[model samples]
Target: MKKLMLGNEAIARGAYEAGVRVATAYPGTPSTEITEFAAQYDEIYAEWSPNEKVALEVAIGASFAGARAMVAMKHVGLNVAADPLFTVSYTGVNAGLVIVVADDPGMHSSQNEQDSRYYARAAQVPMLEPSDSQEALDFVKLAFDLSEEYDTPVLIRLTTRVAHSQSIVALGQRADVPLKEYRKLPEKNVMMPAMARKRHGEVERRMKALAQAANDLWINRIEMGDTSIGIIASGIAYQYAKEALPNASFLKLGMVNPLPRKLVESFARKVEKLYVIEELEPVLEEQIKSWGIAAIGKEIFPVQGELSANMIAERIAGKALDVRPAQDLPPRPPVMCPGCPHRGIYYVMQKLRLHATGDIGCYTLGALPPLKAIDTCVCMGASVGMAHGMEKARGRDFSSKLVAVIGDSTFIHSGITGLIDVVYNQGASTVVILDNSTTGMTGHQDHPGTGRTIKGDLVPPLNLINLIKAIGIRHVRVVDPFELEEVEKVLKEETQREEPSVVIAQRPCALLSKESKIPVSISEDACRLCGVCLRLGCPAIEKKPGGMYINQTLCNGCGLCVKVCKFGALRRAGE
Candidate 1:
């Protein structure tokens, strides 16, 4: 049966049909839905592991037990899982194993656009790139087969466009494949120096066999057309190229790594002008050039961000195809939500003239217009480390003017290590963790601090206070961020300390406040015309001709405006 499916959903369906027995992943955008969807199938055991490293390890363990297993994560998450990933390549697998790395080329919900195809090459594993939802489903099933056939984990790479886009996919019946018997062979399972040396040779042999398989597989095929130009593209880029130049001969590669060199050479010979269309890094282009093939790639296409049919058509215009008229598009910049709790925190920081070092989260919106309080944002867990480094370089008094702001989920993700660095190094930077009780930046997925699992099972939440104290921090305070005076006082005191400190601005996300019964309203009496409350930047607070008004529908009753109002014009409905 054909049905409309999201690329992520198609991956789940593919795993089910491929007789997958186990699936694991950490919650990350463009990839989170894969495991979430997989959990719905009764035939598969699916879970959200603590982190990418743990998720991959869990999947690897399942594979060792002789069951088909898969792990999914966003591109940056692969960096965390890289340790196990590289070694697993040498050990191979008892049953089929697949690693799905969904890449964000345009940094859609990511910090960097590092290519995942490079990981496949570095790990000596086969990589598959699918163009659409249907191809996504097909490639995943094929990936499992290829994995077991080669006795190596296959990498299924998906970009933002392919992971999130919707397309029609033909469903298939689930095959009942039994687990292979596990054997206790230390020489094969254990990675000692001697064993690893032998395994390395095995990996080389397996790669050669896989490359030969790639040459004959229908996954990488040639489309005969006008011989004047042959376009070599992979994944969604192939879809874009097909739309951009319908008449061009094509070499669409599904196996990105260990590319079918023989097939590529043959395709290159057929067309006079060869062009490689891909996003971000020229992985295919560089490899083709290495094979002594003259091809045009980044010289004609951009080397950064995503590519669309419109972009390709425009870039190759006059040279290869006619230019299409530019279509009018609406402007939609990402912003903090209407009643975001981070808004008040950033507003207070701005008022106090504090230079803030920000971490990755919804609070990163503070770097945008209206507030603009955050000075520097590097990556996940960088806030505390960045602040410490700055303090050591510039001295205490200079650093005292800065505060490091990170989210609760991000703090657990990688901030704990940086926090430890601050305490051990004797740096006097104050770190404020915005505890919104959820991973608000990525669709409210639960994290280590949330006290809930991906499947909504209750788990003991990591206590940030105890963690801070254990890190040797003497001063640690938790304050409701809605109280402006309390927050300002805590900030002032923490920054004055000679030792590292932590201030958790504890409050549910404004979006989640109603579920927690946080207060919301504005009083018409005790009115003053002052607009200080409006400066908090909560969309709930608006300015009318008479005075500031609160939209009850939008307000989470977090009382951030009430704290900002000196005239007591903002108050709870009953108060």
Candidate 2:
């Protein structure tokens, strides 16, 4: 049956049908849904690992046990898992292993637009790039076959457009593939210096075999057309190229890393003008050019952001096609949700006029207008380390006044090391961990601190307060972020302390709360039209001609506005 499925979901379906037994990944955009969807299959044991490295290691172990396994993560998450990834390539898997790395070319929900294709080349792994959801599902199954055939792990590279967008995907029944028996082989499984040297040679030999396999792979096909222009493209860029120059001779590549040199040279001879149209870095273009073949790329295409059919059509046609005109989307700036727990903490930080080093999560939205609380946001788990370094350079008093804000999920990802750095280095900077239970920024995926699995299985949640105390932070305190007074008091006292301090602003996410209960509203009679409550800047609260009105539909009843209202206009239901 054909059904509309997201690229990520299609990958999950692909893995399930391919008889995958285990799936693991950390929650990151463009890649989070793959694990979430995999969890729905009873045959697959799906999980949200604490970090990307752990996720990859878990998948690696599963593959070593002779079961088909997969690991998925965003482009940056690849960096965290690179250590295990590079080694796993040396120690080929017993069962088929596939790693999905979703790249965000436009920096959408990401810190940088670093190309992940380089990772495939660096790791010396075969990579498959799918242009749409159907291909996403098909390529994953093919990746597993190729992995087992070549005795190597495979990498499936995806981008934001291909991972998040929806397309019709055909469904298939799951194959009843059983786990093979485990056998300990030191020469094959162990990565000792002597063993690794032999494996490296095997890896090089596998690359040659992979390149030969790519030469006649059905995924890499040539569409015959006008001999004057031949365009080479991969992934979503292939979709754009087809729409742009429909009649041009085409070489659409599926396995991008181990590029088919013989096929590319053969196609180059057939066409008069050879142009490679791709998004971000010219991975295929550079390789094709290196083969002593003249190709036009990058110079006629953009090196940043995403590519669209219109962009390709305009470039190839030398004029704008009769495509839909660009629509002016209203600037819907992201704001803190109504009764958001982080609002009170950010409000206090803004009131005290302190600079905050922020980490990735919903709290990063605090750097936007109205709150304007955060100063620097580098990446996941970087805030604590950056804050510690800044404090060391700026003096204790100045550093104490500064704050580092991180989320519950991020702390588990890599923030623990930074927190230990603060304790060992004796930095007086205060770190505020906003524990909202779930990984809010990435669609409420379960984390180690969430007490649940990707499939909603009950698990023990991590206690942030106890964890901080165990980290040797004597000045550890937990406060309700809705209580502004307590938040301010905690921030002020912690900043004054000479020792390292930790303040956990604990609360459920506003969106999650609303999904379980009827939203609360403002009581106009008790409201004195005071603007103090407005300081929270909730989109649910608005000023009317008569009094301040709260949109019941938007309020989550976290009661952040109630605490801010001096006149007690906001109250609980039936109060």
Candidate 3:
């Protein structure tokens, strides 16, 4: 059956048809949907791990037990799983193991545009790049086959466009391969120094064979077109280049690492001018140049952001073609939901005129507009460490004014280590954990604190307050974020304390809660037109020529504006 499928969904379908037994991942943009789609199949045991490291480890364990396994994560998530990634390279695998790392170029939903192809090269593993949804499916199946064939883990890299885009994919029936019998093969599985030394040689020899085989790999193909210019491209860049220069002869590579050197040289010899069309770093261009081949890449094009057909044509064709974004469309900026729980907390912080160190998640939106509560956001779990450093750098007066805010899932993911650092080093800072029940930023996927597994199985949720206390926090308190007075009081009390403290902003994500706050409106009679309520920046609150008004249709009546009102202008519905 042929159907339109997202690249992520197609990968899941491909894995199912290929008889993959286990799949795991921590939710991250451009990669989260892969595991979500995988859970729909009964043949696969799918899970949402606490972090990427654990996710990769789970897949590694499953593969070691002779089941074809897969793990998916965004590019930076691979950094967390790098330890296992390197060791597993030396140890090899019993069954197939494919790790999917989706790179977010253009900083769409990422902190940086660190190319993941480097990870494949660093780990000495074969890597594949898929240009569209169909290749995403086909490449995953091929990745598994290559993993088993080469006795190595395979990396299937995707970018934002390819991961989120949709295309027609021809589905296939399941090929159920029974588990390989497990034997006590210490020489192959163990990573002791002596064993690892021998395995290192095996990895080198395997790469040599794969590089030769890559020459004839079906995914890498040559299309005869204009002989004057030849383009070597892969992943989304190939799609752009094909559209940019339809008549340009092409060498499309799917297996990017352990590059087919002979094929590359052969392609270079065919055309008068050779161009390497790729995004970000010049991995291919540099490699080709090292071989004494004349290839033009980033020098002609850009080394940053998503490559567009217009961009490729403008650079290579030597003229700017008619290309412009839709000018008629209105600009829509990102904003927190009307009843977002993080909204109230940020509003409170703004009222107190305090500094905030922010972590990843929806709460990062607090850094924008009327609230503007956050100061710094580096990466997941960096806020706590940043807050402590601020205190030490500026001394007590400046540091006491700062607080670090992190989500429950993010706190568990990487913030605990920072908290440990605060306690051991005697740093006095207030850390507030927004316990909103689930991973909100990445489509509300279940996390360790949600009391449910990825597959909807009931499990005991991790207690955030108890865990904070266990970390030797003497002053720990849980405050309802909706209660403005309580939130302010707790924030004031915690920031003043001489020791490391924690304030748990206990509230479910407004979207996830069964109850909704009564939507309120502006009372015309009680209006002083002070514009204090405007500071909350709720989308429902608006200022028209007539006067200040609330869009009842959009309001959730969280009453944060009402709490901040000095003249009692804002009132509840039906009041």
Candidate 4:
């Protein structure tokens, strides 16, 4: 049967049909939906692990137990999982293991445009790139096959465009693949120095064989056309190239890591001008050039963001194509939603004029304008460590004026380690836990503290207050972040404390919490056009010509702005 499916959903379906028994991943953009979709299939045991490293470990354990396992994460998440990735190459796998790393170009929800194909090259693992949903499905099934055939973990690289885009896919029944019985082959699975040295030679041999096999692989195909211009492309770049250079010949490569050199040389001989048109990085261009072949890439094409048909066409045609002119719409940057629990905490932080070392999650929005509560955001758990480091370097005065804020999910991901460093180092750094009850940034996936597992099974919730107290934190307090007075009082008190302190700004995210029916409004007669309410940075509150207005639909009736107004100007519309 054929069905229209998102590339992520198709990959999940392919995994299911390939008889994948175990699947795990941490929630991250462009890659989060894959696990969410996979969870819907009854045949696969899917989960949201605490972080990428744990997720890969879970999948590795499953593979050791002779189950076909798959792990998924975004490009940066791989940085956390890299420790096991390189080692696993030498350890190999009992069952076929496929790891999906979705790369985000254009910084779409990412901090950086890291090319994950480099990781494939670094780990000595084969990598696959699929252009659309059909190939996403096909390649996942092929990845599993290749993984076992090569006795190595396979990496499937998905970018934002291919991961999110929809295409028609042919569905298949589950393959009757049985679980391979586990055998404790120390020489193969264990990575002692002697075994690792042997496996290293094996990995090198495997790569050479894979490269030779890649020349004949059906995934790498040559389309004959006008030989004057030949383009070598992969993933969404190939799609863009096909749309732009319709008349030009294409060497569309689906297997990108161990590039097909024989096929490349054959195609280059057929065409007059050779061009490598992959996106984000010149991975192919660099490799092709190393092979003593001349190609045009990165020099004329951008090494960032996405590639569009018009951009490719314009460059190929040597003139701007008749395309839709760009629109000058006012930029609509993403902001925290109305009645977001994090807002009140950030507002209090800004009011106190403190430097907030920040961590990843929705609270990162605090770094945005108007609030601007956050100062430095390096990674998942750098906040607490950074706060303590600053105290050690700059002395008590600076530490007293500094704060660190992190979300509940992020705190569990890696922030706890940072917190331990602060408490152990004799630093008087005040760390604020933005306990919003869910992983707000990554579409509210369940975490350890959320009282529910990814499979919707109930679990004991981690008590943040008790956890802090047990950590030897003398000043541990929990306050509703929506309560402005409490939030301000706690921030002021904690930052001034002599000992290391923890303030848990506890509130459910407005989107996850049961919402109030009543919406807020401005009393024009009482408003006085003071614009103090605007300071809250809530999208529900906006300015009009005659007076201030609140979008009743957008307002959650949290009355955050109402609490901010000293003039009794803002209130619930009914009140």
Candidate 5:
């Protein structure tokens, strides 16, 4: 059967057909949907692990149990799972194991545009790059076969465009491969120094074999056209290159790492001019050049952002296509929703002039004006450690003016270890956990504290307060973020303490709340236009020539603005 599917959905379909028994991942964009789609199949046991490290570990355990297993995550998430990844390369796997990492070349929904192909090289694993949904499906099944055959894990790299784009995929039947028997082979499975030394040599031999086999691999093919210009590309870049230079000879590589050197050399010899087209980093260009092959890449093309057909045409073909430039529009920076619970906490923080070390999540929006509350945002769980570091650097008194802000899901991901460090080291820092009841930034996915699984199965929720107390934080306070006065009160008290403290601002995300919204209104007669309410930065409030008016259409009637206004200017609709 044939059907239209997203590259992510196609990957899930491929896993189901490949007889994958287990799947795991942390919720991250460009990769989240892969596991979510896999969860629908009754044959696969899918889960949302706390973080990429735990997710990879779960998949590893499943693989060791002699079952086909897969794990998916975004490019940056690979960094989190790298610790396990490097060692797992030496141990190999009992059953087939595949890791799908989606790269965001344009930083569309990510903090960085990291190319994941380099990971495959560093881990000495075979990497597959799929161009479209069809290739995505095919490559996954192929990756599993390669993993077991070589006794090593496999990587399938997907870019933002290919991952989100749709294409028709030819479906296949499930393979129904029986689980292999697990044996206590300490020499092969255990990674003691002596055993690791032996496995390291095996990893090197496997790479050599895979490189030789890649020459005959069906996915890596050369399309002969006009021999004037030949472009070597993979993943989405291949799609762009094909559109830009349709008549040019092309060498499309489905297996990117341990590159088919003979195939690349043969193609290079055939064409007069060769260009390596890829996005983000010069990973392909650097390695290919290291082999003393003359190729053009990153010199004429950009190293930053995504590549487009227009760029390829202009640079390689020297033809100006009649593509209209997008008309400049007014900049609409992302802001907190009208009724966002996070807004109240940021307002209180700004009022108190507290320095907030922020972590990843929607609350990072607090760094934007009119709140301007967050001081630094490095990565997930960095806030807790950074806040503690600042206190130790300056003095105990300095901690009184500093705070660390993180979301509930993020806290569970990596912040808990940082919090434990604070207590163990005898440091005084204020940590604020914004319990928004969902992973807000990634389409409201469930987490450990959500009391639900990826399939929305009811489970016992992890108690945040109890966890904090157990972490040695004695002064723990829970406040409704919607209640601005209460939030402010808690912040003032928590920041004044001389020991580690936690304040969990508990509220359901505005989008998740099914409560009726009675949009608030501005009392025109009592309006002073002092711009106090405007400081909240809610999208519902609009500034005009005459005065400030509440855009009722955008307001969710949370009355946060009403509390911020000194005068009786803002109130619920109809008084």
Candidate 6:
């Protein structure tokens, strides 16, 4: 049966058909839907692990127990799972193991555009790239087979366009493959120095065998066309190149790593001009050039952002396509939602002139104009560490003016270790956990603290206050972020402490919680146009020509603006 499916959804379907019994991932865009879709299948046990590292480990454990397992995450998440990723190559697997990594070339929803293909090479594992949803399904099943055949973990790489784009995929029947028997092989599974040395040699031999067989692999095939030019591309890049140069001879790569060196050389010899088309990094181009093949790549094409059909046509074909230019539109920067609970916390922090080291989440938007509260945003869980570092550098008096802002999900991901570091080192740091009741930025996936499983089954929620207290932080305060006065008081009190403390801004996400209060209004008769309410940066609060007014359509009636207004100008309707 053929059905329209996203690349991520297709991956899940592929895993199910490939006899994969376990799927795990931490919620991240361009890849989160893979595990979510997998969870819908009764045959597959799926979970949302606390972080990428834990997610990969869970999949590894499942694979060790003789179950076909898969783990998915965005490109950056790979860095967090790198420790196990490298070692897994040496230890191999008892059952098939697959890792799905989605790359965001244009930084559409990511911090960086680091390519995952490099990870495959660094780990000495096979990597597959798919052009569309159909190919995504086929490649994943192929990945599982290749993993078991070679006794090595396999990686499937996807880009933002391919992962999000929809296409027709032909469904297949699930293979009821029996689980392999698990053996207690310490020499094989354990990574002690002596055992690792033996396994490292085995990893090298397996890679050599894979490389030798690459040319015969069905996934790396050539399409004959005009011999004047040939383009070697993979994943979405192949799609773009195919659209731009339909008449050119093409070498479309499904297996990107273990790069079919002989096949590439043969393709290079067939055409007078050869171009390597890829996004972000020159992984393929650098390797082809290393093999003494003369290829045109990053010299003519850019190494930053995404490549397009227009760009390929203009650069390689020397003719610009008749594509219409985008119209000049007003710049719409991302902002906090009208009734976002995190907004009140940021506003209070800004009012107190506190420096906030932010982590990855919707709250990172606090660094933008008006609130301008966050001082630095590096990555997930970096906020706590950076905040502690700043305090130690400048001393306890300086810590009174600084705070680390992280979401509840993020705090659980990697921030807990940083918090522990502060207590162990005898440093004073104020950590603020924005408990928004869901992973807001990543489409509200449940975390451990959310008291639900990936399948939405009820589970015991991890209490944040108890966890913080157990971590040696004595002063832990929970405040409703909508109560601006209370949030401000707690923040001030926590930051003033000479020891490590935590202040949790507890509230459900505006989308998750229905608003009961009436939309706020501007009392123009009692109003002074002081622009204080505007400082809250709520989209609901707007400045009109005559006076500042509330945009009722945009307002959630949380009354954050009303609390900020000093002149009794902004008030909830009928209040």
lDDT scores in order: 0.87, 0.90, 0.91, 0.90, 0.92, 0.93
**Which prediction has more favorable lDDT, 1 or 5?**
5
TM-score of 2: 0.94
Predicted structure 4, TM vs. truth: 0.98
Best-first order by lDDT: 6, 5, 3, 4, 2, 1
Collision pairs in model 4: none
Candidate 1 accuracy as TM-score? 0.92
Least accurate 10 contiguous residues by lDDT in model 6 = 321-330
Query: Candidate 1 regions off by >4 Å?
Result: 317-332, 515-530, 542-557, 569-574
Clashes of each: 2, 0, 0, 0, 0, 0
**What are the models' TM-scores?**
0.92, 0.94, 0.97, 0.98, 0.98, 0.98
Q: Where is the poorest 10-residue window by lDDT in model 5? A: 317-326
Stretches of candidate 6 above 4 Å error? 321-329
Worst 10 residues of 1 by lDDT: 514-523
Off by over 4 Å in 2: 321-330, 514-531, 543-549, 566-575
lDDT of 1: 0.87
Q: Candidate 6's C-alpha lDDT?
A: 0.93
Model 5 misplaced stretches (Cα beyond 4 Å): 322-328
Residue-wise lDDT of candidate 6 within 419-480, one digit each (tens)? Answer: 99999999899999999999999899999999999988999999988988998999998899
Query: After best superposition, candidate 3 residue 369: deviation in angstroms?
Result: 2.2
Query: How many pairs of residues collide in model 4?
Result: 0
lDDT of 1 by residue, 38-157 (tens): 988889998877678889999999999999999999998999899999999999999999999999998988888999999999999899999999999999999999888888999999
Q: Put down candidate 5 lDDT per residue, 1-575, tens digits, no spaces.
A: 88999999999999999999999999888898999999999999999999999999999999999999999999989999999999999999999999999999888888888788889989898999999999999999999999999999999999989999999999999998899898888998899999999999999999999999999999999999999999999999999999988999999999998899999999999999999999978888898899899999999999899999989999998887786867897777787777899998998888889998999888988899889989988888999999999999999778899999999999999999999999999988999999999999888899999999988799999999999999788999999987888888889888899899999999999999987899997878899989989889899899898888888789999888899889989899766
